[model samples]
Target: MKLRFWGVRGSFAMCGREVLRYGGNTTSIELVAASGTRLLIDLGTGATELAKLLMQGEFGRGQGELPILLSHTHLDHIQGLPFFTPFFVKGNRIRIVGADPPGLSLQATLQNQLAPHYSPLNGLENLAAGVSIDTIVPGSTFTLGEFEVETALVPHGNMWTTAFRVTADGKVVTFLSDVEYPEPEAPLPEALHLARHADLLIHDAMHSDDDYQLRRGWGHSPARAAISVAEKAAVRRLALFHHSPDATDAMIDETVWRARAETKIELFAAAEGSYLEV
Candidate 1:
């Protein structure tokens, strides 16, 4: 499988010369299987740039079909939905998959995001594309083309966020964003399961140790916490992801540098537009 990071920032989007290197778009990623099946994880602001690129292919002609796996409905994660160009193309098909929140179904939650008060698009019905929403149950496994996907629910402050493990062509990639590790030195069983011996693990590194002290219940993990998970899971490679919005490029560089010192696993910060084959 081929993986690309379109956005990696956390909480909100940020821009300026200070953020150019690591990028400022919030949590969107694209994964493509060997059979050319495309899967998108999250619809953060970075999706708009991805939309521009997809417009050059089948999506531009409204003949594309793909599944978007959302971690949750947080604004930074879904803010790019309305601006995603394929949604305005009549023949395109989009299946949005995510865990159902407390009271709202997955579909209703998304519809609420696009409601008149929040968006000019009014609702999902206003989109030209044939959009379908699937509410995935935690701990269930599903297949999307050649990719076998496994979902697990992990604690995220006051809510539960879905973590995905996707396997294809004998390779595994695990994505665990927006999760807060209760114990910095101990890995959650669900998170360990999703990342165990995986080829690549993209885990949240949204805060520094000091930042985490003040934002303990904000549904984000510090860089050291992510490293601890990677070590416990024994993942082949670790990509520090979901960067804090307040983090400058230099700060992220320091985070990566510090994380590298504690683990023998290959590590790097996930940067926008960076691609990896697993």
Candidate 2:
């Protein structure tokens, strides 16, 4: 499996000279299995660029299917769907997997994002016709090409967000962003399950200890907390994700060092455009 970060910022997108190194887009990542099967984790603003890149190749040519696993319908996570170039093409197909939200269905949640008042595109009906959506059941395991995927629930941002663990190319990788450690003393049981023995654990590091002290329930963990989860999960590599909009390259770099000084885990700040071969 090959993993790449298209966006790493959390909460919202930020721009400035200070963030140039890490990037300014929200949270979206791509994983390609050994059989060339592609899976998109989120549809953040970075997906615009990814769409453009895909169009330049086979995906744009409407040659294959796209499977998207959305964590939750946060604005920063779903805002890019309106701009995804693939939506405009007729022959393209997108299979979306999301956990149904309260009151509205998963499809309706995304449809509302593109509703009349907010977007001129109006609705998903105007986009590709070959789209299918399904809600994921917690703890369910399924196969997509050569990858084995597992989904679980986690508390985040006043809602239950989905966490994913994927096994491919003989490696296990977990992605659990926008997660909140409400207890402040222990980690999520699902986090432990998904990240256990993982080659890469892409967990949220959107805050620091002090930040968590100030914003305790903001659906994110500090760098230290994320490091602790990696240690407890026994993951081989910890990729710190969902960087705070306010975090700079230097701050993230410092946090990386802080995590490294405390443990022997392979830790790195997930930067946009950076690729990890697993």
Candidate 3:
């Protein structure tokens, strides 16, 4: 399996020379299985660039089929869907999969984003692609193409974010973005289960210890929290992801440096446009 980070920043997009190395776009990831099955995680601002690249391939010919797995409908996570290029192409099949938010269906949540007052496209119906939305139950296990996926609900403030564990070609990768560990010293049971013994753990590391104290109730984890989870889960490697919008590249480097001192596991910050083969 192969994984790529298209965007790493969280909360919102940021840009400037200070953020050039780590990147400035919000979260979006691309994962491809050995059998050539491709999956997209989130549709953040990075998707705008990913869209441009897709438009040069089968998606450009309107003969592409892609499955998008969403952790939640937070603005930063779904904001780039309207700009996803393939949505303007007929015959491109797009399946959006996610757990619905409180009192809302997955489809309804997305349609709300494309509502007349908010989007120029007016509504999801106005998109030219053949789009379908699937709402999955939290803690469900399912198969998509060549991948076996397991999901668990992790706390993200009052809302719950879906943490995904995907296994393909005998390798495992767990995505635990936007999750906040209630107990700073230990990993949540659900989050630990999803990340247990995975080849790679891509986790939310959106704050530093000092920053986290000021935003305790915010739906994000500090690098130490992520390191604690990685240690408890015994994952092979941990990729600190979902960087804070206000964190400059230098800040993130410092965060990684501090994190390395806390854990013996292979660790690195997720950088936009970087890929890993597992």
Candidate 3 worst ten-residue window by lDDT: 179-188
Q: Pairs clashing in candidate 3? A: none
Quote the lDDT for 105 in model 2: 90
Q: Whole-model lDDT for model 1 versus the true structure?
A: 0.91
How well does each candidate superpose onto the true structure, as a TM-score?
0.98, 0.96, 0.98
Please give the range of 10 consecutive residues that has the lowest summed lDDT in model 2.
Answer: 123-132
Q: What does candidate 1's lDDT look like per residue over 1-278, in tens digits?
A: 89999999998899999999989998899998888889999999999989998989999999999899999988999999999999999999999989998777888888999999999999999999958998899899999778889999998989989999999888999999999978877878989999999999999998889888999988889888888888889999999999988999999999999989888989999999766787
lDDT of 2 by residue, 100-186 (tens): 875669888888888999998788787763568878886899886677889988888678788999888898889988888766448
For candidate 1, which ten residues in a row score worst on lDDT?
A: 181-190
**Number of colliding residue pairs in model 1:** 0
> After TM-score superposition, what is the CA distance of residue 91 in candidate 2 from its true location, in Å?
1.3
* Candidate 3 structure quality by residue, lDDT tens digits, 1-278: 99988989998899899999999998999999887778989999998988998899999999888988999989999999999999899999999989999788888888889998999998899999958998999899998888888999898987989889999999999999998877777788888889999999999999899999999988889888888888999999999999998999999999989899888999999998756897
